[model samples]
Target: MSHHIVEVKDLHYTYPDGTAALGGVGFRITHGESVALIGANGAGKSTLLLHLNGCLIPEAGTVRMGDFPLTKKTLPHVRQTVGMVFQDPDDQLFMPTVYDDVAFGPLNLGLPPDEIEDRVMEALATVGAAHLRNRPPYRLSGGEKRAVAIASVLSMGPSILIMDEPSSNLDPKARRQLIHLLKSFEHTMIIATHDLDMVLDVCGRTMILKGGHIAADGPTEEILQNEPLLHACSLEKPLRLQGCPVCNPVRA
Candidate 1:
C-alpha cells in the first residue's frame, strides 16, 4: 500500500499577498490512516491540505504522494490518487442534479457511459445519497449536499480522501450521521476541521497547526487532552474530554 502513503518534507508556501501559510511543515501518513488536522483559523490546515492534491504547489519543499513526487508531470496522477472535498458542499455540487454532480469526475476521466452510470450509482450508494440522485443539488439540506460532494470524490476511485471542515453547518443529527459515515470508509483520510469532538470519534491521530506551523502531532486523545498546549495554540480540550457542568459546577 505504498501507493497510498502521503509524505511531506520541509513544506513551505506563501501567498502573493506575502502571507505565509506553511512553514517547513513535514509529516508522513501511511496507508489507511485516519488523521485529523485541527487548529484555530489561519493556522494553515487548509493550505496544507490543498498541497496534498496538487491544488497549490509548495513554493519550497517537496510533497510525495505514494512513490511519485508532486510535479506538473505527476500532477494528474496525484490528483487521481488524492480526492479533495472542499469545506462548502455547494462548491462541489455545481451540476444541476445530484447524479450529474457525482458523475462529473468520472466523466472527466473519459469513462464509458455504462461505466460512468455504474460509478455514479455506486458512489451515491456508498454515501447513502442514491435516493437523492435525481434531485437538484440546491434543493438538498446541508448534510445531503455534503453526502453528494463526498460521493463525487468517491466516484473518482481515489486512495486518499482529504476533507476540509466536512461537518460545518450540519445539525446535531446530521453531524452524527456524518461521523458514522466517516467511520465506515476504509480510504486514507485527512480531515481538517475545528470540530475537535468529532475528531475524537473519527480520527486516531491529530496534528495541531499554529502560525503556519505544526505545534503538536500525536495520538488524538493525548494531544487533545493537553490543556496548556491546546490553549497556547488557541484550542481547548474536546468537549467530550471536559468535565460536565452539571456534574462539576464551577464556584465563582
Candidate 2:
C-alpha cells in the first residue's frame, strides 16, 4: 500500500464569478513522490496548486496533508508543511533585499534570530544565490530573483513543495540551475509546468488535467511518450523525443 502524504478527495472549486475551476478532482501523492501537473492554459493547474497549501480553499471537497485535513484551524500548520512557488518570482519576492526576503518565512514562525539567519544563509547557498543576498530584489536578474524566491520558501523548511510554471521565464542556464537545486530536495514535490523536460528530469509520476478534471495519471515515462495523447491534450512531444538523432532516429 502506498503512503500518501497529500490527498485531494472529490475536490470541487468555482471562482467567485461563476467560473468552474475544478470539478470533483481527486488524487493522492505518495510520500517522497515527485509528480508533474501537466495541462494547457486555463486548465486549472494553478488553482489546484493553491489548494495544496490552503491558499485557496476548495469550494467543495477535502485537501489533506498527512493526517490533517486543510481547514481554517489547520491552515497555519498546513502552510508550514507545504511551501508554494508561484509562476512569477515577483509574486513572492517583495522584500527590498534578497536576504530579507529569504529570512521572512522563518522570522514569521518566531524562530530564534540566529536560526533564521542560518536558515537564510543555508537556503541562499542551496540555490546558489548567496552572492546576490545583499543586493536589492528588484535589481537582481530574472534567474537571481527566481533563486531567491525559492530560497525564501526553502528557509521555511517545508517537506511538501508545489511549484507553478517554475521554468516559465527562465533562460536555459537558469532553468538548469533551478532543476539541479530542485533535485537536491527531499520533499514530496508537485510541479505544474509546461516544461516537459524538467518534468522528465524531476518527476517519477505524471498527472494530466483538462476541463477541471484529471484526464490521466500514471508513470511519467509512459505518459510523456504518448505523442497522440499529448497532442489530444494540446501538448506536444518533449523536444528530446522530437527528431533525436540517436534515440528516436526516425520521427514517428
Candidate 3:
C-alpha cells in the first residue's frame, strides 16, 4: 500500500461573502512527494491549503492528514503535522524578536525550555538565518522575513510543509536561496505558487487549479510543456533548457 500523507475528497468551501473558494476539489499526496499547486489569481490555491491545516473547514467533503481526519477535535493534531507558511511573512511572524517568533510553535506545544531553544536554533540554522536570531523581525529584509516565517513552522517539527507563494516579493538572489533551502528539506512539501520555474526545479508533479477546481494534474515537465492548457488556465509555459549536441544527440 502507498504511504499517503494528505488526502482530500470532493472538498468544497465557500467564504462568508458567499464566494466559492473550493468546488469539489480532490487530490491525494503520497508521503515524501513534492507537489506544486499552480494557478492564476483567485484560483483558490490558498483556500485549499487552509483546508489542509484546518484553518478553513470545508462546507462539504473531508481533508485527511495521515490517518486522522480534520475536525474540531483533530485540528490541533492536524496543525502540528502540517505546517503552513503564508504568502506574506508579516502575517506569520509577530513576536518582538526573531528568536521568539521561531520558538513560538514549539513553546506553544509545551516543550521544555531547553528543547524549545534547541528547536529554535535548529530551525533557524535550517533556513540559514541563525545569525539574525536576536534581531527584530521588522528589521529584516523581505527574503529574511520569509525565512523567519518558515523557521517558525519548522520549530514544530512538522512532517509536511505547506507553503503559499514562497517566492513572492523576493529578489533573484533571495529566490535562489529560498529554492536551495526548500530543496534541502526532506519533509513532504506542497507549494502553491505561480512560479513555474520554481515548480519545475523543486516539484516533480504539478496540479493546476481553476475556478476552485483542479483543471489539470500531471508530471511537471509534461504539464508545463502543454501550451494550450497552460494558456487556457492563465499560466505561462515552462522555459526549455539548452543541451550540448554531444550530450543530447538529435534523432536522424
Candidate 4:
C-alpha cells in the first residue's frame, strides 16, 4: 500500500474533562498533497492530527493510513508512515546530541548500526543540519533546533509528514528558510498552524476547523481570500494579501 493517502471518516473524540473535542470530522488527503489545517483554539485540529498516528484513539470513527485502519494493531506501521514534528522543538529534541536525536527513531526500529548512521546523516543533510550533528541540541538556536527536530522525524522515513505550528517563534530569515525547505519536500504534508502567510507559501489547499468540525475546505487562495469566512473563523487574510495602509490610505 502507498501509505501516502490519509482518510478520516466520521471521527469523534472527547477529552477526559468532558470537553467535546471533535464532534464528527472527515477528510481525505491524496498522495503528495500539502494541506493546511487552521482554526481557532479548541477547534479540534490537534485532536484530529493525534488520531492520524494513533497518538489519540477515536471514540466513534475511523482513521486510515493508505489501506490500513489506524488501530493498536496497526499503530506501529502508521507511526512509521506518518512522521510528526511537534510544536516545540524542545519537546522533540531530548537526546544529548543532534545525531542521537535523529538516530533515535531508526534505532527503535531495530535497524543495523550502519543503516541507522546513514539515515541519520542523510536526514540531517536534508534539513541543512549536517554541520551541527555533533553539537548538543540544547546549544543550538531556535531555527537550528527546529531543523534538527525535523531531521529526527525525517530519519524515520515517513511518507506523510504532520507538523504542528512549525514556524512559531522563528525570526523572518529562519521562517523564510523553513518555507523554502518545506517547498522542496515531496512528502505528503499536513501542517496545522496559525501562520496564514506560511500557508500561502507552502500549501495549495486549506482546511478550516471550527467548534470541533470542519468549517471549510478549498483552494488556499480562495479560502484565504474570503474575508467573511476568515473573520468568522477568527482569522484574517495573510499579511501579504492585505492592502498596505501606506499604499491604500483612506480619503475624507
Quote the positional error of residue 15 for candidate 4 in Å: 0.1
Per-model TM values vs. the true structure: 0.98, 0.94, 0.93, 0.97
Q: Candidate 2 has which clashing residue pairs, if any?
A: none
Greater-lDDT candidate between 1 and 3: 1
Encode model 2's per-residue lDDT on 2-100: one tens digit a residue.
Answer: 223999999999999999999989999988999999998888898999899888988889999866799999988888888889888888998888999
Candidate 4 segments exceeding 4 Å error = 250-252
Q: What residue pairs are clashing in model 3?
A: none
Model 1, range 1-252, lDDT digits (tens) per residue? 899999999999999999999999999999999999999999999899989989898899999998789999999889889899999998889999999999899998999999999999999999899999899999999999999999999999999999999999999999999999999999999999999999999999999999988899999989998999999999988888988889897553
Over the stretch 1-252, how does candidate 4's per-residue lDDT look in tens digits? 366999999999999999999999999999999999999987888988888889898999899997689999988889899999999999999999999999999999999999999999999999999999899999999999999999999999999999999999999999999999999999999999999999999999999999999999999999999999999998888988988779796452
Q: Could you arrange the candidates by TM-score from highest to lowest? A: 1, 4, 2, 3
> Listing every candidate in turn, what is its Cα RMSD in Å to the true structure after a full C-alpha superposition?
1.1, 2.4, 4.3, 1.6
Off by over 4 Å in 3: 1-4, 240-252
Q: Indicate the residue-level lDDT of 163 in model 1.
A: 98
Index of the highest-lDDT prediction: 4
Q: Candidate 2, which ten residues in sequence have the lowest lDDT sum? A: 243-252
After superposition, the stretches of candidate 2 with alpha carbons farther than 4 Å from their true spots are 1-4, 244-252
**Model 1 pairs in collision:** none
